[model samples]
Target: MKQMREKRQPADGRRKSILSQLKEAADPIKGNDLAEEMQVSRQIIVQDISLLKAEGQPIIATSQGYLLLKKAQSHTITRIVACNHTVSQTADELTRIVNCGVTVLNVTVEHPLYGEITRSLMIRNQSDVRKFVKNLEKTGASLLSSLTDGVHLHELEADTAENLELAVQALKQAGYLL
Candidate 1:
């Protein structure tokens, strides 16, 4: 068996270029695909992605693939609807929002330097919510809701301001949001 020598990228830095490609992309790409495009082994691509993320790059790995999130739309109405619950009720609370046909765009938690660290969820259906929760358990990831005394903010998507208002009101009535 031969050891695969770790070849360093040249000054042009294909890895950085590849990282930029992912950052500028609208959608996620698989490691295999990125490897093919960059003319490197999939292992190298994985290492590159990890390094990019370690350097504070905003990258998300999902079942679909890896995505580079752009700055969220400022024009879009983003009301911070506060919800508090026991960890057990997390799934149902999310189900309520998605059932109303609104997309759960992101969840936010406070960080010392960043102030607020928000992860974009983009979940729009029951199935998506289910998968998300399931994977969270499978991966042993803690819920952000666990912080802030089981209180969290959901950034939901709606066509109009009226729709957004109704979604929050419904959540409030459901005792999910304040």
Candidate 2:
């Protein structure tokens, strides 16, 4: 395993390398891939990520992988909208928002003990929504809204204020806005 040590030696600078890689990626990078490239265990990559986050980097871990959340682009608008709906209404709620051409950046739910729990979504279109729903079915995981009795918040981003307004109106019409 001499060659393995030589490869892992590069990981001496891994934290910086990981940050650079995450910053350069347009999508989330898988932890397993990161660990393989660095010749280290996936747990090491997770620890490195924790340290990086502790250093104030805006790294977000999604169901897909890890992403670095940078500043909003020029002319982009972001709004945190409050929504209340049952689990069955999730697809409709997300579809309406995405149909307005807005990106669902994350979902937030308040927990009695944890205060606010936020998970990055990064869903941009119908296909993304479908994939998200499919994964949910495959995993059989409970929705976060189940924790707070169907109350949650979504951080939506759009290129225009009109789009955000449209999405909010749609959600309101669908009885999702609270």
Candidate 3:
């Protein structure tokens, strides 16, 4: 396994170093810095990041570089739920959560390598969802539904069970949550 991976030329010595640098970084770290420290090409660092993310590492690439999300805590108060609906239903579902006074934190979809790839979206209102949907249309990027066949998970937050339950019921009644 190691030999096969070596052909991919992942920064073996640099993996740990990059990880260490990432640990101390409050924000994303640049690919070049990661490459220089590892004594490898920046392209190699990119590939290494791909490998790490594939292995279930919570790394996010921003314009600056890569930011490793702090893993979800076991005692998180928010609830993660899977819902299936048409692409057209995305906005209403998101708006429902916001209207019910909950913060829609993240959305997750399965990636071939990275298992569940989650994107943080701190959406809080109908306008936010509208803006998001507009951006999706603007980018010409397909929704996660295109990948998960209309199934997606939402990490939603509220102060109490009643609030969360209200949002869930609202989604179910709207034919969003199945």
Question: Against the hidden true structure, what lDDT does model 3 obtain?
Answer: 0.77
CA displacement after TM-score superposition, residue 152 of candidate 1 (Å): 1.5
lDDT per residue, candidate 2, 1-178, as tens digits?
Answer: 8888876745448999999999899878889999998988999999999998999999988867899988877999999999999888888999999999999999999999999999899988998788788888899999998999999999999999999999999999999999
Q: Write the per-residue lDDT of candidate 1 for residues 25-56, one digit (tens) a residue.
A: 76557788877766678887778878888888
Clashing pairs in 2: none
By lDDT, rank the candidates, best first.
2, 3, 1
Ranking of all predicted structures according to TM-score, beginning with the best and ending with the worst:
2, 1, 3
Q: Any idea how many clashes model 3 has?
A: 0
Question: lDDT by residue for model 3 over 1-178, one digit each (tens)?
Answer: 5665554434565676677677788756879977666556799888888888888877777533577877666544588888888877788889889999887877888877668877777676776687778877787878766688888898998877788999999998988885
Q: Whole-model lDDT for model 2 versus the true structure?
A: 0.91
Q: Quick one: best lDDT, which candidate?
A: 2
Best by TM-score: 2
Name the regions of candidate 1 deviating beyond 4 angstroms.
Answer: 1-47, 50-65, 69-76, 111-115
TM-score of 1: 0.63
Candidate 2: misplaced stretches above 4 Å? none
